[model samples]
Target: MFDFIRNHKRLMLILLALLIVPGLGLVGVQGFRGFFDNGANVAEVSGSKITRQEYDALLKEQLERMREMFGGAVNTAAVDTPVLRQILLDSLIQQRILADEAKRQRLSASDEAVRKTILEIPALGALRKSDGSIDTEKYHDLLAKQGMTPEQFDARVRRSLAIAQIGDSIEASALAPKSSAAQLAQLSMQQREMRELVLHPLDYSAEVKPTEEQLKQYYDTHQKEFETPETATISYAILSAEILAASITPSEEELKKAYQDNLATYQTAKQVRASHILIATPKADTVASAKAKAEALLAQLRKQPGQFAEMARNESQDPGSAARGGDLGYFAAGMMVKPFEEAAFKLKPNEISGLVQSDFGYHIIKVTEIKPAQTRPLSEVKQTLLSDLKKQQATQRFAAAADQFSNLVYEQTNSLTPAAEKFNLVVQTATVARQAMPAPTAVPALANPQFLAAVFESETLKGKHNTAAIEVGDNTLIAAHVTAHKPASVLPFETVKQGVQQKVTLLQAAELTRKAGEEKLASLQQSKSTAGFSPVIKLSRAGARGLTPAAVSAIFKADAEQLPQYVSAILDGGVYAIYRVESLSPLPELEPQRLTALQQQLAQLTGQLELNAYLASLRARSKVKIYATENAAASE
Candidate 1:
């Protein structure tokens, strides 16, 4: 057989090639076939697919952000919920859609724009040099920690900016009609003088009586409220950075190095609050003419310095600060143009500057307040540096032991004791449930959904074995051994009868209160009387006069065209109230500042609506399909 095979080797090779060619053709290419069958693609938008790897990466990034925002109080497990997963998946699809649209429309971000955006990120502030340029070495090192090259990060940011331009263009084109805004502002600012006659539930409680039949019915209907959740008595061990940090101590040299590396963060920049009168060289005026006008204003301000605000309001070309008496507010050294900043910083407090020329024109500046630069001494920041260094070392140590901790919990499945001893962790006991604990900072390891889900696994629960080690947070792993399990059950009706009776009494009292309040409203409507009403109080959206939102809404919705209009609302604690609408006082005219603010708010709302409609159109025209995964699926 060996001799025959050796002689027929070329023939066998030819036959194998013939068998594989058709399979490749049937699948349209083995590479693409493998990609589709990888079982990770979550959605297809336009012509591109969103893979599960992409979904999980984004989910992890969002989780890290939320963890940072709430510290350890944020539930890492809660972020994995189906609703959040769907939202994230939809976000990914929408981003893909927008990116595709941007590409189709040939929209792009310039290198300068991308650089400006990168420099503006607050996280990268430490990497900026004193000259306001990025430190190339530090920037590269920061990107290296995130496993990205500078080019890759730039490309990502450029793509994001291009997609953002689409929405920016749409928003800029949106215009809220002046009349509509005025009408809406009138409704928002309109105040009503109203008085209330409240029907207290406590007052009506004596008239209502609960019976045994009602208590039994209420208990049966709301049985879940009386039931105890399924809980497990478990012994768990935590391997956290804080635990590891306890054994580690940084030397003085390390602390000094860390402090030196982040020296910029320990210092504050000098700032000055100054007012300026700008005679802008608009198209109508030449630079010479604007400078002459500014010189005249400076001449006037020199004699009557206190009247500088009046001169700025009457003559300053800059509209933004003209209303505020040319007060440019407090700004740091780098905030203003080169010429203006130099002149402002050179002046002492209450000192005025001569004609300083810039692109805007010539400016007369007055320095009102100055805040000096401040730097913290090394000794004052030593403890913070020490704490940070300890955590850095501990995080490295935790990474080294995480796999070992995982292996120990799995290999010795019957108990968490082995893992606890190996990692020098304390095996603490607690009663945990399927849902998270109510207290924000109580038992985060047990509150972790992944850990809790593992604890509830049939094998782990039935065999009384340890759950697999789960990463609940950054540098935190947890494993648990179920000591005992109690299934969920409802308490007996007889035991909860008294509580049920209290609830029934409130329901009955609320009914009585509502009826009495409604009858009083009808009587007031016919009699047109303000008898038994409290003193009239002013009401608007901004000032609710201590009324519940529902009550306020009911009062505002009533017909105030006729005086003494009547309305009723049910307040909290089963208190009901009847309101008598006395008079409507429409704002005759919104103040200039408030009018401008209202217009801006209305424009923003209009822009958002237009953006939503634009996104909807894009979705309609594009072909988007979502694939179901084991986790969750976003709706099409």
Candidate 2:
């Protein structure tokens, strides 16, 4: 891939320039002009200029895609610059690999194919009219709104199609068999049911006492476990979400107006429960056909309002709603499209609206009731308003004090006394472990990189100076000086004696139980009878009920040929269990739908595996050089 890119660099650059030149008028290529000027130009292949700017743009797009995939729940702080750079570089390398491969294979898409693919994309599709033909004016208007020209849009689509073609060819070759689907299904469907009995070694400790020498030896062997974990005494300032919320304070006038404007939102709208018969336009793109369909539906609705539900059940294209006799039960304002919402909201009780056009098609709405909106008095909302007001006030106060506090702490040099005195804030201390000093919910601003970096710095712990103030969250700041520090060290032997003794006892008990269970099972298998056994244990055909993983594992290991197999292992709640499988059953055959779904899943898995393999191959062949130190310095 690198060789191809290097050899065809000039050609690739020319092709890229040609492709993007037209779009430059709209997208402004100035931002991207010097993208590869300083950075090492990694690859430019087949008239495609893979510059730093281009890579960054792709990285941003990928991030946006991830945000969309996660429904916008991803934390911005989690997006590390180094990680994003690596991802972008890898993606660019893979594209170069595939592009080279495509060229070598002479894989190409025809003009017609490219055009068809572009037109089929929903973003590019023309708005539908009564007839099926494209609505040119609507398409033009949409392009104008997006600040793009048809030619530029088409060119962009062409490049996308080219990339997709290369990807598809590689993916198609990587497809695997559907039989894997059945295997996966079997694994997922496999389940075991068993009963368990647990025994604890501690229960028998009274009967067997260890010698003094043995106890001493155990204590000497394991000292670390009994010792406390390394601890740190930290001074922290907390900025809790609840505290922030409490700080806000809303004005009485603001509260009143907010309540009045959103009165409808507070009250439940009277929902009309009605069904409709829809005769959709044959071709929504053509004005004439849409008008005709609307007119015909209007005539039918006017003639017999009673048959609407029956007609909808018989003829509605919306199968999901049609199954319920077109019943769109009780929707309020904003529930439907603009046209439908307007029509529904305007109708009186038991009144039917004339034909209305929505994006879906045409609709005939019937009103079942006119539910009057409800309102609550100011007194009822007074408490809520007060809480909001307090939160606002707190936020403002915190913001005002943060800068002053930060300056005071720094100026104090080695003490939090100045800041504490200036703000009347308590200087709190924590005896938490270094690993746990930053509480799980500490504000990010308070735990900023500077503060964390300072914590690990030797000078900060020596009490040379107070650490710089850190912004942990909105309107929150923190600065700290470590009052005491304990360097990490191995614990003494005496501290861990009890823990070692407990471990030894548990190991010994497990060994004893395994041996005893093996002997019992062997005897049952050979004797074929419980005559000599102290107690004849009854085994259920389905094995034990409600068996845990540990118990089941222990029991399954017992000699199966032997009857009355008794194995005891520690289970939950200080108990042990033993069991034997009296019988085994095979799984039932797969149902039709399940089989089809499994096959589809297997196909998708195969595609993903192929893509992964291709990426791995590209990485292996590429002349990739990473200057990690240089990159880190640049980022810093």
Candidate 3:
């Protein structure tokens, strides 16, 4: 269930409704005074509260997971506030439904079950010892590293397990009849063999010549299709982030001071090298036994320190570092589990520590080396400081220019030339049609509603300056001018004649093909062969590619090999009449693995079908209210 939730995160989030604020009126009634307060209340499902802070954390984690899944190709910024809100809201709703159902059914995860599931989680199992015990110190350190207390982590794990158990119960009971599987398999295995010959309409083009009067009549009837669409030409002022960034400059002194103030950020921390042996416990309840085994291994390590690498290579449960004699290469102070980090950092070179305990099991660490922290010189990051300073200055400059540009176009009612002259800005023109599209520069201002509204305004189109400067990004703004305009008009007929003719021809062809196919099927059925078919119909042997599965099944199920027969089937492009089934062969018996896989697939499909049907039933019964207009206004 957790895997399913992770895989279909977006869908799960939507179904949960953990984030979205439904309506401003509802929000106000719920005691939300402003946008921030409303947004902070992620969702209230029944009486359960999903706060904004919790939703944001989950959203961030999900984004990080997605980034990892896509190998970082996805733009993090593209996952905007609305999208995140929807995701959280969906997740919340799903959880609410599940929780309610679970409570009603008295279905809950047992303490033992929760513990077992937690023990299986790989993240918590990474700190074990060679003798299979939970490394207490390492466990504490791991919790500290994650900024979570042990109790808090355990509670979260328990909640997750309980939810998973509920989901499992729901899915486990879903079933499909054996007859349904057999029917599906039969349909899937069905095939058809047929022959076809296409007659192109263009072949009769020479016979389609019409009188001038007929052509004129056709043109008169379909005049609208030939007319041109309304078009517009607009002059615009571009204030882009790159342009602003290029214009602003920062002094040398500023860069040095900025670098000095953030000294820790420009310094590299000391790293320690260590190695360990691990033994894992499959269940948290077996920690006592695991600890005993860890103690035995610890004694062996104490007796022979030189045998550490050999023992780690042979016994460590960590596949990642076990192959390399359990060598955890150089890691900084905060990188390792807290207990391990503390022990490793405290040790001198070549010093070996006693058995270390963590969440996974027990471990014995040896510090191979330690490097001192070093500060980076100002010269190394001077360019980065300058760039940051420039962006700040550019943002301010762009804001000032944007205000002036807006007033000039809206208030003064003058041309763009005045604003351009004042700001040393160039006037640009767009070849855009009435339909909205991103500008060549991908400036957000050009695509904004204000700009779009202004472009269509009568005042802006009539050579009057009725426009405004819009912010595109942090340091980008746009001031637009309406240069040309054309009123909406209907299309003319001549341009649409060919298209209509093609449509009519295709319809005629389909009808003709169906009629021919039906006749062929009848004749063949009467004679048991293609003995009296016209147009020199040929018989070709081929499997079904486009025919409906039901039709294909009827053909294949018929005793065609014993007696030649005719079967008609509707295909995507045309109809088909298969006159004979030349042969029949039983497929090979399914392999054990293939059979198992098929069963699993069938089970999953059956479960999904049941789940979908249940959700559909819920949707039918529930009163779902959508405030789309309100939500849209809020977004704008």
Top candidate (TM-score)? 1
TM-score of 1: 0.70
Say which prediction, candidate 1 or candidate 3, comes out ahead on lDDT. 1
Over 386-496, each residue of candidate 2 has an lDDT whose tens digit, in order, gives 675566567667655666776776787678877776655667775544443334433333324344555656777765577776643334566677767776665665555
Measured against the true structure, the TM-scores of the candidates, in listed sequence, are 0.70, 0.53, 0.62
* Residue-pair clashes per candidate: 0, 42, 42
Q: What does the lDDT read for residue 213 in candidate 3?
A: 61
Q: What lDDT score goes with residue 81 in model 3?
A: 36
Q: Model 1: how far is 195 from its true place, Å?
A: 0.8
Inter-residue clash pairs, candidate 1: none
Candidate 3: tens digits of C-alpha lDDT, residues 1-636: 966764553334333332232211111111111113434454554555556555445555555557788985443224433545455545545555555555666665567865665565566567765445667898888777656677766655555555555445545776656556655554454443433333333444444545556555655666565455556677888765557678677787878888888888889899878887877766888778777877887788778888888988988888999999989998886556777777788888877787677867777787777888999888888888788878767776775776777677666566778877777778888744554443333443455444566577776777656476654333456767766777766554455656666545554566666766677667666866544333423221244555467565556666755655555566565444453554444444545565554555677666667776775555344333222222322221
* lDDT score for candidate 3 against the true structure: 0.60
CA error at residue 369 for candidate 1, angstroms: 26
Q: Using lDDT, give the best candidate's number.
A: 1
Candidate 2: residue 242 lDDT (0-100): 41
- The true-versus-predicted C-alpha distance at residue 362 of model 1, in Å, is 23
Q: Candidate 2: list runs displaced more than 4 Å.
A: 1-221, 239-400, 437-457, 471-475, 481-496, 511-608, 621-636
